[model samples]
Target: MFKTLSRKTVYQNRWMKLHEDIIERPGGIEGLFGVVEKPDFSAIIAVDNGHIHLVEQYRYPIGQRSLELPMGGWPEQPDADPLALARGELQEETGYVAEHIEQIGYHHVDNGGGTMGCNVFFATGLTFSGRNPDPEEADLEPMTLPLTEFERRIKDGEILDACTIACYGLAKLKGLV
Candidate 1:
């Protein structure tokens, strides 16, 4: 185990904060460590008929459009349940509400540094509703694709979000997708 010697705030921003630390490792080596603690998030894999619901958005930082499941973090509502967050995000991003929602799993997105984890949910019996997307989420558009086509997109690297992929992969492995 590594023991933290000292910790200092390296950066602080509205969305996320970072900490730098001096640590003594179990191997008796002293080194610097960086940690980023962001709020936990939730994502939904909503399936209706034989199609999977996804959102297409232009990610400014990546300068490309990404196809990902409905996902969001509620930093201000940290105490809120992840299932509620999942339901809210699904409706906000995709305008779909599911009668059945099951917790698939959680994933550490960047275990090396970031403390961001995403709770994955499997949503079924979906019903459509009007979307109330956030202004910051202007580029998002909800789309449904056939399960086969979605899997093809993933295999073709068209779907690159790790959390989304991990969730679907686990769902498939467990024969839940």
Candidate 2:
């Protein structure tokens, strides 16, 4: 077991923080662990008329366009419900709201570096509207693709976002797709 000795904040921003912790490992070795963090939240895998709703955005860190599911973090409003967050993100990122939203599961994105878990949802029966994307997310735009094309992109390694891919895969395995 790893026992924490001390924890100190190393960085802080609007969305998340970084912490450095001194810990004693199971083998009796004492070391430091750097952690990046945010409040846990949910993402939605929405499908409508045989097409999946996705978002295309330029990730500045990677300097490339990426495709991903509708996702968001509500750290500042931690008390807000996960279901509401899911619906809000679906609308904000995809400009679509689902008439049926079902909780699928939760995923730990990076257990080694963070405790941030994303709640996964399967949504259907969508209605489109104008998007109200956050200013910080100005580079994002919603796109729709057929299921076969979406799967092909995954197989080709074009869709690189792990959380989005994992959630969709799980949904398919569970016959929700």
Tens digits of per-residue lDDT for model 2, 22-105: 999999999999998888878999998889999999988888999999898776796578899999999988989899998999
62-174, model 1: which lDDT tens digit per residue? 99999999999776776579999999999999998899999988889999998888898999999888898988999899999999999999999889988788989988987
Q: Candidate 2: which pairs clash?
A: none
TM-scores vs. true structure, each candidate: 0.96, 0.95
The stretch of ten residues in a row with the least summed lDDT in candidate 1 is: 71-80
Off by over 4 Å in 2: none
Q: Largest TM-score belongs to which candidate?
A: 1
Off by over 4 Å in 1: none
- lDDT of model 2 at position 101: 98
What is the C-alpha local distance difference test score of each model? 0.90, 0.91
Model 1's alpha-carbon lDDT is: 0.90
